[model samples]
Target chain A: MITSIIINGILIGLIYALLAIGLTVIFGVMRIINMFHGEAVMLGMYAAFVLFDKFGISPYISVFLTAPIFFVLGSIIYKFLIDPIPAREREITSLIITLGISFIFATSAMYIWSADYRTVTLPFSQDVMVFIKTRIGYPALISSCMSAVMIVGFYLFMSKTYMGRAIRATELDKDTASVMGVNVKWISIATFGIGVVLAAMAGGILSPIFYIYPFVGSNFVIKAFTIVVLGGMGSVTGALVGGIILGVAEALASTFLEYSMKDIMAFILFLGILLFKPSGILGGRTRL
Target chain B: MFFKILSSVLFLLLLFSQVSYGAGTFKIGCPAPMTGPGANFGEKFKKAYTMAADEINAKGGVNGTKLELVFEDTQAKPALAVSSAKKLISSDNVIALLGGWSSGVAFAVAPVALDNKTPYLLEHPALDDITRKNNDYVFRLQPTTGMYSAALEDFILKVVYPKEKKKQLTVAYIYVDNAFGQGVAKYGIIPFFKKNKDKFNLVVSESYNENAMDYKPLLLKVKNAAPDIVVLTSYLTDGILLAKQIKEVGLQAKMFTGTGAGHSMQDIYEKSGKATEKYFSSGPWHGEIKDANWKKWRSAWEKKYKYVPGEHEVEGYVAIQVLAEALKGVKSSDVVKQREELKASLKALNMKTIFGTVKFDNFDGYTNQNKAYKMTAVAQWINGKLLQVWPKEAAEREPAY
Candidate 1:
């Protein structure tokens, strides 16, 4: 029982890692918290639903559709909403603006889709593997694998590409990067877009397994933020660690205590980390 | 510009209300969650009752005066429900009202209707608290949390207990920690077993935040108790997620039971497929019933909706049917006279509906509460379809555990 719980915890941890990574990536480069990231994920879930409901497209196929559209949408959001505010007011402005965007996203989804819970039940939803008498669900396995691929792919993108180095430079110091001839504005916008793509991908991967609705994103956003903070600001690896820790903690807590009490434990752990290790697990590194 | 459009809409509503009040129409002020979180539910409610009312209107109006349903958007919020109730009472001058989806909204709006002595029949909101307050003017046609639990108990005694080959009658509750869920715990399943201590043993009781993503740990706790039955109380998404997780964790008890409403959704069988096989649940309405009227309505509804009407939406249709039957009995359009006549009609109402028979019993101080011989439809998921399997007379097939 404990082993299965641990495995389930780690599996969910990987998905949380993916979402936290997206939030961290945006914060890594732009230093502006994309409060609408959850909304972006919510859109991804709905996108999958529409494709599945109307066009008979699977979420696996819908991810391809969601990615490019979300990329363009994210870019537009950054260009118009995030960039227009002066840098001096950028942080607060973007926060409030993204909150509005989030509200619009949720309310619009509520209006258009209605508040009915939707799920894309695939063939592999219940197909499972047993190891040491522990059940491993296919949905969780496939989603965890997708998260891994995306994380590794992101790492490769950051280390190898010229544009990636420019983004890294902006992360290190924006003004200094501007002095070094890097287009910091373009880097921020691109990072925001990429961040949304990551969140959307997470949404697509989980759409088959998790229940989808208008307020679905709100469920993950707080946890995503908690993971980002637990991992430390701008620490890519921190997201992975923070997410795993949080997931495992929730799993063990729920096993021992009530399910609601598990949240209390997670929040307590969050507070403990903040009180003692404010720098985070791998904070101040500023690495992608 | 927004205000102009808003006011224009308001003006139209006001003008319509004023024009309808001119002798030839009977205004009914109702609250629906047409524009908020409860919009889908509200939409379903509006459709069901409107279909019932429209059918009556098409047949040449209810006693010469056309029934003008003035539906105000409550959005299932308590404040909105109260305001809308007030607006419907004062501005619309509706003698009777309906709608108020959530239990809290129903409870909140009930007092406003009671204060004005308007007949406010709650369509589906069911909390023990709503009826326990003893408001004579406020009436409920929906199943209470306790009733749902009792219905589950009925299934256990009728189906599981009779069929069990071994000595295993252990039960557990893995429900959401909300008013509806807790009410089910407090006034619902717990009380029945408390009386039937020899019949069943309550092994585990677990609660969680409704939106909590992880249900595995909770399932593990339920598994530890080694319960024969696991009862869940949750909303649609939570119900679906928990049921999925229950299967994913591979916890197989003798039977998995759902308290009601949230568990009775068609999407559960649709989404989970074979996972929900043999899952027992109780609902306010099941498409399969032993009545010609219900059968006709079901066929008509399915012909139009492309699916069977769920229990959640059917309550609205039933409430209105009872209300309509009561109004039709009264023969008066005058507010004071209609109100008096409506009360007498409702008090003596013995009409049949697509949902069930309508007869409010004020037994045990539950003033004007809808009563029935078999208020619950105990159903089991069989091959992705809910088959009514209890109340032997209503049973399509024997309940299989």
Candidate 2:
């Protein structure tokens, strides 16, 4: 039972890491919280749902389509909404602007979808694979693997690719990167685009496992934010580790204690980490 | 001077028009969660209310006055409900109120209704205290949380245990942590189990916050407990998640049932796919009532809404019909006297509607609650359809289990 719980926790944690990685990356590069991150995830879910419903495309396959489409959408948002604010006021202004965007997106989705709960029920969605008394749904297993691949791919992109290095340099010091002829504006756009793509991809993969609704984004946004804070604000690896810790802690708490104490346990761990290791497990030093 | 005179004439005309419009219609304020977790209930309520009002108006309305519904979005929050109630009573000047989708919201709105002396007909919230508070102004159509599981309890005691030939069975409960959930467990399940302690053993009783994305850990705990029957209380989103996760975790129980709410919703079956097959839910409406009006209403509702009406829609539609019936007896000239008369009329109401005979009687420490009507009807998901399976008279199909 404990083994299954831990394994389930890690599987879910990987997805959580994928969800938060976008927020952390955006914050790392632009020094602004993308309040619309969750809504982007919701939109991705809807996009996947539509493709599944209309075109009979599987959500796992739609992830490939959703990523590129959202990449373009993210670049457009960065160009119009995030680019106008001056650097000095960008952080606070971008937060408010993104929040407004979040509301608009949510309201629009509700108007379009009529607040109904939608799910992409694939043939294997309910198929359970049991190994050593541990039951894992095909959707959960597949989505977790997708999340793991994306997280690893993101890490590789950050460390190995020149564009990723440019984004990292911009995160460290935009002025220095600009002086070094990195084109900080382009890096910021690419980083924002990547962040949006990651969030959308998470939503696409999660569509089968989670209900798709306009307000569903709110359910995951808080957790994503918590993961971002718990994982040293900008560190991709921190997000990964923090998500696992929180997930495992939650699983343990809910299993041992009452189920209602799961969130309380998560927040307690969050507060403890804040109090003791304010920089988080991998907080400040690892920017990427 | 000429332009000023024309403006004065237009202003006076507008004022008189507003007054005449008010005189020709009776506005009922509806406070519902139009945009939150409970938004689906609100949407159904809106549809039911609109349908009832349209039908009523088409037949020349109550006392030759058209029924006007003033909707206020409460978001299912207590603070928001209170404000909506106050706004409805004060600014909207709605003669009566309808629709409270959550217990907390109903509790908050009940006080405002009492304070303002407005007759509030609550369609959905099932907390027992809403009526037990001795507030005459607030009347509830739905059964209290405790009564929700009555039919399910009967099915378990009579059909399930006896048919399975089990002398004793272990039960586990997973409910949303709220007034409704707690009330069901405290006032309903606990007492029933205690009454039949020799036949039942409660192994696990757990509560989780609403709108939670995951229930794997909770289900794992339940799995460890290994109860024979698992009872749940949840709204739509969490209900669907619980069903799916219960299947994913491979938690095997002889019977899985829900005390209404999301478990009774069609969305759960559709969204959860085969996970909810054979699952039972106990609620007020099962769409299989043996009555012509019920058949007519159900057909019309499904035809218009493109989905079958559930307990929420039934309660919403009936609340309107009940209020309209009460309003028919209100012949007082004064506004205050009219409200008082409406309350009296509601207390005196003993009508046979499509749902059942709705009589707001005082019993079991409850005031102005429709205790005359049978509240619980058990429905099960059989072959992708929710079919009434309990209460032999109302049963559309036999219990699969």
Q: Give the candidate number with the greatest TM-score.
A: 2
> Candidates' DockQ values?
0.54, 0.78
Q: Which tens-of-lDDT digit does each residue in A1-288 have in candidate 2?
A: 899989988988998899999999999888889999999999999999999999999999998977888999899999899998998999899999999999899889999998888999998888999867799999999998989888998899999999889988998898999999999887888889888998888899899999988878888888998898898888999999988888888888889888888999879978887899887789866776
For candidate 1, the iRMS in Å is: 2.0
DockQ of 1: 0.54
Q: Model 1: how far is B141 from its true place, Å?
A: 1.6
Q: What is the TM-score of chain A alone in each candidate?
A: 0.95, 0.98
For candidate 2, the per-residue lDDT at B251 reads 91
Docking class of 2: medium
**TM-scores for candidates 1 onward, in order:** 0.89, 0.97
Q: Candidate 1: deviation at residue B243, Å? A: 2.3
Worst 10 residues of 2 chain B by lDDT: B283-292
For model 1, the superposed segments whose C-alpha errors exceed 4 Å read A50-65, A107-116, A274-279, A285-288, B1-30, B34-39, B70-96, B115-118, B328-350
Alpha carbon deviation, residue A94, candidate 2 (Å) = 1.9
